[model samples]
Target: MATNAQLGADDDYIVVRNPSKLADLLTARNVDPEVVTKYLHIIRGDAKDCYTVGKTLYGINLEIADMVVSDVGGSTVVKPNRLRPTLDDPTICQDVVSNIPNSLKRIELLFKATPRTRRKPYIVVISTTGISNHGRDIAVAMDKKAMEGILLREIQTGGRGASVIRGFTAVRPSFLTDGKPVGAQKIRAAVEEEGKVAKSAIGYTISRGDVGAWIYEELVEDNAAGELKYVN
Candidate 1:
């Protein structure tokens, strides 16, 4: 089981939408309820909306350093960039000296400071239907080889924004429908096994509540540690 401390408070989790579901699951499991309330963080965007999802998920930012330039003949010449921490840059030494106290200050600041933006391991929920050619008959359509290909290439590429984190467990669930909580017992989950399909692995339609419970029971509880799993 990964602790909030091991995975920093701010960066421990990267949920996409309806983070409340993950929180609800964690609470039911008797894990630290406050962990979800205080530490569980989310990437703000919709995965379906690819256009701006990356910016929202990663919170893109840019910093421009001041550049030194001189006029050489008719052209403006910019100074060559120097390696950081070189003898020419005394600021690097100063930074090293200052970081110790700053580190201590950061610890103290954690109590009041807004959670810093950092990447950590994540359990990403996605659709098996996205990869399967068949709609409800995805079980037959998704073979072991096809599952591997979708996970490796398609999912990897589409989810590249969240890939910067340590790693992620892609939870490929069957058809999802809104209803009462199905409870963890009703859900079936397994690692990417060849020949596994919707009917053989688990049921076809899974409730959103059950999906949440499965994430907590299987992925989070077992400490999946970055792997792909199918659930229903």
Candidate 2:
């Protein structure tokens, strides 16, 4: 239950102990000068703790020294650190249900248990088409079946789960493939409309890398807040 302020004061000495060396290492990595400066500033700030840097900051642990990255569904996901439930990071509560359980109740518990101040915006990925509407397409049908019952429901409308969080940006993309990034030119974002899939959100297959890149750009870098964006 250590506050960010307390963690910062206690950890500053580790980084401040050798700023010049750290700067040299960052410079060697060819990291942007501005990014390096910002990191240094944060390291010296009143809350000199290293909180999460990517997408959402809610489930990240600042105490870890190394940056954490994960390969999820063929996409590389980067987070400032990992969340260790009940140990260092009590803010996160995760559970995997094998058989049928009270999903709503479970989700509700996770939502209500987390402190309001600790909540952060969520970046969710979903299918552009739903099974009920696009059941003809095998991929869309499978996606809908897999996501509709749990992830989509909780994120889109589950009471405290989505409604109580700081904010959420739901990205619904078309079929995904492993290829080069499509870049911004081929990508588009629009407000979600039921039973009406736009041309940009249909008959297109985007690279997994491109999807990850878009999430990083819109959610992490641009800090794009609320709204559901359909991309392809």
Candidate 3:
């Protein structure tokens, strides 16, 4: 079990797309909900589109920090990605509209590969930004029992965005050239925090779209490790 505070050197930070999933993950890791919530503050209970990038909150440019969990009862798993949404794109109605079908399909596969369990795995979405109408629509669509999960990411009106948005590892780093590293100090800093670090490091690197890809790999790896098991 891992707590929000008890991170090891090799520990990788994760983001989930749902709340109930988050609760379940923390329980498995033996993390206290009060403590987890303390680390996370709710901005908009609803949905909106936006994310905070870096120390300053950015508009459409955003980041998602998450925690992934394995279900105890059922092979179904829940993943939570706490985000800071920004409504910088007024014309667009929101900043980000997550690729819903792709995400759901990934979950669907994970569920099928792992045997059935009493614990129905689902998603738990949290947003520093408010939830958008689109986000809500997606959530509703995903609420089917067969899917039997959720999607709850959004942006808020004006809650304290500082704590909620900080300490997050970006899914992608802003700089990377053929596995070689090249970037400004800020990007370097972000990559170091997000990925594995070396003692005699040459430099830092991260790809923006690579975060999701990496997460997918991790999920499969977890399955291989028996974190995702096959029950009779």
Candidate maximizing lDDT: 1
Candidate 1 residue-wise lDDT, 120-169, digit = tens: 33323333443533334453322222323332442255475533233334
TM-score to native of every candidate shown: 0.40, 0.42, 0.20
2 against 3, candidate with superior TM-score:
2
Between prediction 1 and prediction 3, the one with superior TM-score is 1
lDDT of 2: 0.38
Q: What is the lDDT, from 0 to 100, of the residue 51 in candidate 1?
A: 30
16-55 in candidate 2: lDDT tens per residue?
3256666786687587877655333322221122221221
Error of 3 at 171 (Å): 5.8
lDDT, candidate 3, at 230? 14
Candidate 2 Cα outliers beyond 4 Å, as residue runs: 1-117, 126-141, 146-148, 155-170, 222-232
Encode model 3's per-residue lDDT on 1-232: one tens digit a residue. Answer: 1112122222333223466776786697688877766454423322222221111111111221223221111122333532422222222211122322233234434444543211222122111111222222121111122111222221122332411211111222222234432223323221222233322322233542242234334333433343522110
The CA lDDT at 197 in model 2 is: 46
